[model samples]
Structures are given as C-alpha cells and as structure tokens.
Target: MPNQSQIFNRVVSDQEVWDFNVFADGIYLITIQAKAKNWRQNFKRLFSDDDLAVQVDDYLFTELSGKKREFKGPGTWNGNELKNSSKSVIILLPLKAGAHKLRFWVDEAPMLENISVEEMNPDIKEKLVLSLSHDASAIDFIYKNIEIENLEVKYNDNTHSQKSIETKTDTDTIMITIKRPQDKKVESVIVQFKSTIEMNYKIGRIKLYQDIILSSSVNLRSQPDDESKILESLADGEQINILEEVVIGKFIAGKSYVWHKVGAHGKIGYVLSSFVEIQGQEREKIIELIKFWAQKLNIESSYVLALAGCESRYKVYATGGPASDDRLGRGIFQLTNQLKIDLNDDSKPFYSPISDLFNANQNVAAGVSYFKWLNTTKYKKSTESFKKSVVAYNAGTGNVPVVGKLNLKNYEQQTQNLVSCVLENSQKKKWGNIWWPILLFVIGFFLAAHGFVTKLNYASAQNDITIDAISNFEPDRSIRISSATSSVDGMVYFLANTSFDCGAQNCHSVLFQLDTKSGQIRKIMDDVFGAAVDLFPSPDGRYLALVALVHGGVCNSGVYYDIIDIQSLTNLAISGYHSGRYTAEYVGDNKWQNNNAFSFSLTQVNCTGTQRGTRKGEYVYNMDEAKLLMRMEQFGPENNG
Candidate 1:
C-alpha cells in the first residue's frame, strides 16, 4: 500500500468535482478546511438557508456504474462552528484503484481554504502525496430552480478575463460560477445567465379553424394559476398571440379549464382558453393583412385598424343591430348592405356576394374597396375627407356636416377616439418608443412651414394696399351671401349661387362684385354651369378671379379660372393657364399676392382607370403681364408653395 496526502483550495457554488488516479486500493482520510463563521453567514444570507450542509460523494469507476459512496461534513450555521479546527474529516476503507472522483455539493457558495486527501497504509507508516490548489480573486454563483416540464436551458457566458463553470440537473436546476483571476480586483461579480422553458401541450402547432370570439371580458394574468396577479383586462374579440396551453388549477365548474399564455403589444399574460374560439389566422397575420390592404388603397393602416377595432374588434362573424333593420354590419370591417350598393350594379364585372361578408378575406377586400371609393368620390381625398368617410360609415351621408361646421355629434368623437387608440397600439407594437416622436415632428414641421408661407404671402399682398382704401370703402347693400370676402381696397366679392342641384347635368353658379364708395353692385359672371364654383378678388380691387366648372356635368366637366378686369369687366388673356386634359377643382380659397401675382390650387377630377384618385396642381399667374408664372401638374412636398 502507498501513503499519500493532497490538499485543494478554491471557492465553489452548488456543486464541483475533482478526479484523480490511485495506484492501489487502501484506506484514506479526507479533511476539508474552510472559514466557518464568514462562510456560514454569507451562505445563509445568499441562499436563505438556516444551516449550510457540505455533501461529499465518492464514485468508483464511471458515474453510470451505480457504485457510489456519500459522506456529510459538520453543518455550519450563523452562530455555530465546527467541532474540530474549522475542518471536517471522512474516512474511507477498501478504496478502489484506478480512476476515482470526488464531488462536493454545498447549500451556497463558500470559500474552501484547504482540502487534504491522505492515503495511509496500515502496513507502512508513511503517507502518499496528492495536492490541488485554486486561487480566485472573485467568484460569482447563480442558481435557478424552476418547476416546469419539457424545460430547456440556455447559458451564455459574457465574463471578461474570467472562467465559467456550469452544471445542470435533470430536475430543471442550473448552477453557474464565474471565476476571475487572482491578481485582478473587480468591483462586483455579475453572473448573467438566462433559461427558457416551453411546456408541451396536448395539441401540437396547428392552424386555428375559426375566429376566437371571447364570450365576455376576461382578466389576463401573469401566470396560469388563478392566484397570479392580473396584468390586464381583455375585451371581447381582442386579438391575442397564443403561445401555449396549460392546466394549473381547478375551474369554477369543478373541471380543469385550459389556460393560454398570450402576447400582445409587447405584453405577455395568461387567459382562460375557453373564453376564446382558438380559430382563424394568428393575430399578427390578420394585422399584416390589414396593413397590406390599407397600403394598396392609399389609406393609413392605423386608421383602418382603428375602424376595425371600433366596428368589430377584428371578429370575423361580429354582427351589429337586428336583421329586420337591414343595418346589420358583419365581419372585421363591419360592412353593411347599404355600403355595398355599388357592388350590386350590373355594369360592374364582379359583385360581392352577401354570404362572402362572413369570410375574412372577402370581407376585407370588399371593405377596403368601398372605403377607397368613398375617399375618391364621396369626399375630396384629404385627411379631413377620410374623417368624413369614417363618420359617414358610422352615421349616414345626410348627417355629415359641411366643412367648417364645429358642432360634431357623439359618434364623431367616438370615431376619433378609436383612431387614436389604434395609432397608439400600432406605435407600441412597431416602434417601441423610438420612431413615433420623430415621425410626428416631421409632420408638424411641414404643417407649420405651410402655414407660415401662406400667412407671409397674405401679408405681402396686403402691403401693397393703403389703409385709407380699406377704411373709406363700404358695401352698397346687404346681399344674401353663400360665401363672401372683402379685398384690401374695400371691394366686396361674393358667390350668389347659395344652393344648386349638384347632381344635375346643368348646374349654374353666379359671381357678384360690389363697390363700397359708389354703392354699386354688379354681376361679374353668371350661368357658370357645373358642380361647384368659388370667387376671389385682387388686393387693389382691379381684378376678380372666378374658378368655375364648365361643360355638361360634374363627372365630365372641366374647371378653369379667369382673371377679369373690374374696369372693363372682361377676361384677361393669360396664355397656358387653362385646365388641360383633366377637370380641376379649387381646394380652399385662392391667395392674391399684391396686384400682379396670385396663386391657387386645383385637383384633377376627371381621371379614369388607374388614375381615378385626385391629382393636385398648383398655379401662379401674372395678371398684369397676362402670363402664367408657374404651372405644377402634380403638386406635393417636392413643389409646395
């Protein structure tokens, strides 16, 4: 028999192992020396353990051999010390030869000052030598024990100039240690590790067969168990991303109800699975589809989504009102029979079937198409126009107030609130607090710049007029006015066509001008047949600009503006200033810059085929020279005034 002695000094957490080779089998005595008071205090504080137990394991051959020996050293507590000189000993007899392993499992991380392995031969008086030492400046330990099934652990070591030791148990526990060099002093040791677990459910990854409509509102909790804290309250038909199903506790019906872990707007929570249908495409897929259709229709996807949230909350079979009223709204868009009248026209190639409203794809297609038509035709294809369309869809076309009206009803406010909610939710989903403010700033800057330029132009035009010209002049009579305005030189201009049959083939508009000093009112233009008309006066009162519709009807009519001299009451010969190919309609009021220059916007109204949407144009005219200063066929940010 050979006699040997070995010592090991290091810091360990949870579990650590050491392997060595022996020439012969003999009796051995193992002694473990550690700082009892400091180690025990730190261990108890970190691991919430009342007593720290050091477990030692001796294995013969491989770990799978099932031949193992276990030994427990003296337990240490906050106020207790070991029986012997801060050390414990375990004796082993008939130790096997060849490779052998020793394992130490501790309740918490502790500093091992020394460990001595002594091999004594009863026949020989000498002891054999085997010693190991580890010096670490800092050690960090992290342990995670989660009670979950089908668990998967992922470990990442990001320590700089340090070594890491990792150990995992079959019972879903992970232990990690970060060891730094002895010479280096770190302010603090950070052991970072992450683990993810996916619980297997009875059903594999499968497609939902129908739309999930909640029977009622339900609380979304942090955990599957009912005792978990409530994260949020989900309304009926709210879309959710279902991760997996679980059964945690007993239900109210004395049966186990399935619970689902779901994520929405960066929030993860659990909800009762029975509350949802578990059908239709995933929530993200539906959102993407809405975005795709909105882009194709040149509408804001957030607006469309907001409308869906208000109308049906993204439910496929959501219905509104009774069938007897013929006002039933169906599907995510909540489309009604009245809104689909254009589909019933036999002139069109395809018609939407009433039954198709229950289908998600068909319903979205029809709704987007109808909304596009409303924007292009029913409204003027502006932001305000989109708002008007939303109102009209909620109420009726007759209830839509004219532009400049302020007393909006409750439905309008509700629609606005819905739009805001959709935008907020969308921003949370996509931007995550980064890009939304930048986007809003850009939009606000453009609007401010446009307003500043408009005001500057107006002020410049007024600079050419004398104050006496405005104060001295007065209108001759109190004329019935539809829309009226006064020039800086004390001349009044008004539209006499207060109302007209806009749908008729021949609708007429009349323009009138009044001189304040002379008490004279005269007709500037009359019998301007078309859809709509507007009038503007030059600053010096020398010219009146008339923008009128001309031709057979609203759909086919062309729009033209004429600068007429007040002295001669005759149109000026401004070359290349007439509408070409497309009918132009005025947007807002025209601006007169001084005596010679003036600007106005026109939107093309008679475009066909793919160009059915309105194309805006801007024009500036030199009235004195009788020439066109500028003509932009397509006006936008690239060519803004």
Candidate 2:
C-alpha cells in the first residue's frame, strides 16, 4: 500500500490534509489537507478547471461520465474523514473488479495512483461508476457542453462471480459525451403581497446581505430602516421565472413576520411569500438601464448592449453564469480587477462609494472613464494601443509581461503595438467566407478577422508635415533652384497629408513649409489648404523655394521638391535632396551668390522615438561628412586623387 499515510504526509506538508474514506475495496476518498484553514479546507483554488489536471484514461475500471450530478453545498472534510454530513462530495461510483490507476488534481497538482478495485454487492447492475474529463482547449471550450456536478460512488457486491483482469489504459477510454439541457420554458409569476412585517429594500446587489429571522412571537417595528438594509433586501429579479410559492402565512398579533431570502443559487429553500412582491422579469427595464449608460459613456448603444450581453447577460445581480473571480479576471470587461478595495465605495473608501451598478449613468460613466483614462495616460494617441487596454481589461493583466529596464524607445513603441494588437484581435468572431463588420464594435470595413485595418492612405489632412531637401542655386540666395536631389525624388509634387494631435477630442492636420536654409518646420497652410481640401489631408507636404512636394517613405523613393514661380507659387523644374551633404550648385541657368543652399531632413517621425525591434534607426546628417561631400563635389576627383 506504500503507506497511504506517506502520501498524506507529503500533501499535508504543503496543505492541510482533510478527509479520507475507504470505499468498497482499495478505492479511497481523500480530501485536501490545508492545515492553516483549520485543517478543514478539503478543496482549494475556487476558480479552477479540475478536469485538466486529472486523466482517468482508458482502463477497464468502470464507465460513468454521462450521469447527472449536483453540488450539495457547504460540506466539510476533516483530515481523514468526511464531516458535517453535508454533501460536499457528490460522485457515487462502482468500480469493476480489476487493477487500475486513478488520478485527480488538488489545486492543479497531479495526484496519480494505481489501485485494485472490488465491488460491494454481487449484482453491481443497480450501481453505476462516475468519472470526468474535459475538452482539450482553454477555457473558451468550457461553456460549450454539459455542466457536471456533485457525483457519488457506491458498489454492489456481485464481483465474486466476475473475473478480475489487469489492463493498461493509455488509449481506450472514449470521450465523455456531455448532454446539454434545453432552455427552460420560463413561466413568469406576478405575486403581490405587502409585508406584514417591515422589509428592507436594496438598490443594488443582494447576495452580500445577511438576514435575521423573527420567531412567531416577535412584535413588528414600524420605523424607517437604514439605506444599506433596504438595499440588502433586494433579490435577483430572475427569481420571478420559477414562480415558487412557500404558502406560508403572514403575521399574528403575538408573532413576528419571517425574513426570508427571495433568491437562492440552486438550492430550493423557503422564502417568506409575504415579504417580497414579484413584478415579473425586469428584462426590458434592465435593457433600458444598460442603454442609458452606453449613451453617457459616448459608446455606441450596441457596444453597451454587447457588453451587457457578455457580462451578466442583462441580469442585474446575475451570478453563476461563470465564476468571476477565476484568475483575477472580473467585472464587465473581464480584465483583472487590479484595484483591491471595494470599487463600489465612493464615500468612506478612497475613491468614493457608488450606490449601484444598476444606475445607468454611474455604471456607463465608470466604464468609459476607465477606458478613456487608460487611452490617454498609458497609450498616448494610438487607437491600436487603446484596443489592447480593452482586452487586458477583460482577460486579466497577468498576460501583459512587465519587461524591466527596457530602452525607452523600444518600451514605448512595442508596448503600444502590443496593446493595439490585443484590442484588434478580440473583436473577431467566426463567420462564413469573408469576415464582416460587427455592429457593436464599429471598427469600420473588414477588420478584426484580418487584424486591425489601419488607415491605408485615407489621406485625410496634413499636420506638422515637413518637406525635406529644398535647394537653391547659391548659399547667399534662399530662392532659385540649385542642383538638388531627395531620398524620394521621383514622386509627384503634391504634399503627402499627415496628422497631429491637437491635445483635444480629435486630431488635426498641417502642411509643412521648411526654411531651405534651416531644418525648422512651419505650417504653410493656415486657410489656403484648409479651404482647398476637405478640412485637411493627413499627409506630409513641404515647400522649397520653387518646389512644392510630398514624400512617401514606404514607397522606397526619394523626396519631391517642386520648384515654382516665387510670386505665383506655380510649378517649375524640381531639384532633389542628394544625401550625405551635397551643395546646391546651379548646374542649370542660375547665378552665383544666389541663395542656393538646400537642406534635407535626416529622418521623419510621425510619432517620434526609436522602435527597437522595428528597424527604427536614427538618422543624423554628420556635419563633417556634409562639409567633406561639399568639398568633393566642388573640387572634383582631384581631392581624392
């Protein structure tokens, strides 16, 4: 037996050892042994998928995965035995006569075992076996099938007539077939009964409330109760679906009214019928509240609808849909509730107490304000980063790795892209053929499926646009064309539009006018381009003496410097910004002593800063190199020769 006590000692050394039961034969029932919990915590890690840790493989032990089960709440297991006579353990199974290995998990820890099984009764047909396994993927697959619960195991002793065998169980156990229950045809009830005894009414969550019952001899007190008490008395409006009635009487002169809970998790408990009034399911009212918050938050109504649909399913005080505390992810977005205190309290607590999550304005305001704050402070102005914050909000921040002491440039750029990618990925849902836009997300044309469809040359307006390398024939003269070339010299003279953040609700565009003599940037169009184009075009455009130009770095071309008639600002033959430091000499018809020196932008930054892993190298025009290039161009090959 390998001293079963040794196994207990190993586990108990880490956690308290609780109950253990000897079933029909060598089959045993062992509970957790986490001692600090007064040695009573047989089960640990409340939010976990037990099936992932345990695999009862294909051995010929017994077959019992398709049976019904339930959680008989609040049972306890002492170090070596089941206690409290409560139904914490549910599965009752009969093991076939054989030698087998059984396994399960304790807080995700693997507990593997080899065991010999024996039946209690000779005719074991009356009793069945119980076992479980899970879908292979992550939690996304958990909600897809049947929900199994409290299972019990027992044996019938006809085993002496049957032959015992030893078999290896690497493959044969079939996948457990889960039977999903059909949606219940809910029948709504409308029961109106005034309280014979005073009742408290709560405005928000009812699960957190504690209640006290009055015996048949207490007197009724008719004073206004505290606000907290009233709120606690409220129940889940869905209780109206069952139409359960206790048929208990009101109150007598000598007796007091009973205070009973109108809502329960799954247990069929008694409630004082006269204490609560059923107004039917509040689905419509709940929806209206959700919409109100959506508007206040400035999000689309459908976004709010989708949010509520994903969360409590529009059921205020709704629980049991899924355990919220799993992996520290909770609330509407499913992001980790990083803030430790009761976020509901806006008063005595540091952030102040919110009276109710059901309050449309407050709830919506909170959701939007949280996201908006994240967008502004952590993400700068990138829409993509905003989306990541949204995902982290729903999935828990544990996924966001905190890389310590990274180069600031890489930190900012990579983190921004990370968040943006997350936000973009989460909005996808499978559909046929080409994916389409979701009404709730408003992500614009086909996206989410193919990833974020960042603006592909929508070319709105220009903001802080700089035209690089405008040249003049002579250093003295800032006008007139000198021999010049650009990094992107082949493009059209039209300025490429670009964007700038105006530090307000929206972005603004600007046209770039660079001083040919210096690298300074100036906005050229105050009213001209604004009125000419639709508001503004978000592309870069620069003006050289006679040159008007636009540049595209991605096209792998050179800068376009359009030369124009100074007065007319009309077109003329353009020169390019030759790199490394090239002097503007009028190879064409130009006089010396004319302003011919041209300057080229060393680099362009839409949002400035280097990106480590993204080929974002810095560009600097070396003064010494520029001077040397000028001397080489002016003196000819004899300098090197």
Q: How close is every model to the real structure, measured as TM-score?
A: 0.26, 0.21
Clashes of each: 12, 87
Per-residue accuracy of model 2 over 185-204 as CA lDDT, tens digit each = 11111111122211111111
Q: What is the C-alpha local distance difference test score of each model?
A: 0.44, 0.26
lDDT of 1 by residue, 1-641 (tens): 34344554455553355555667655454544453334335454652322223322211111111111111222221123331123332222333456554554343334556555556443532222222133322222212222111212122232343334344332122223233334443333222222432221111112121112102356678876656898887776565655553444323221123456776546887765435434323344445556655665567666666566545545454555433446667666877777667555656432444445555655776676666565556766445776677666666666765454423334543344333344444434441111111111112111111110101011121132111111111332111123233343545554433232232243344455544334344556554344335556677777777765555444555555667787787766334544444444445447887888878766655444443445576778876566776566664332232
Best TM-score among the predictions, by candidate number: 1
Output the lDDT of residue 477, model 2: 20
The alpha-carbon lDDT assigned to residue 360 of candidate 2 equals 29
Give the Å error, residue 621, model 2.
70
- For model 1 the TM-score comes to 0.26
Candidate 2 weakest lDDT stretch, 10 residues: 136-145
Off by over 4 Å in 1: 1-277, 322-326, 346-354, 381-383, 401-407, 410-641
After TM-score superposition, the amount by which residue 570's alpha carbon in candidate 1 deviates from its true location, in angstroms, is 78
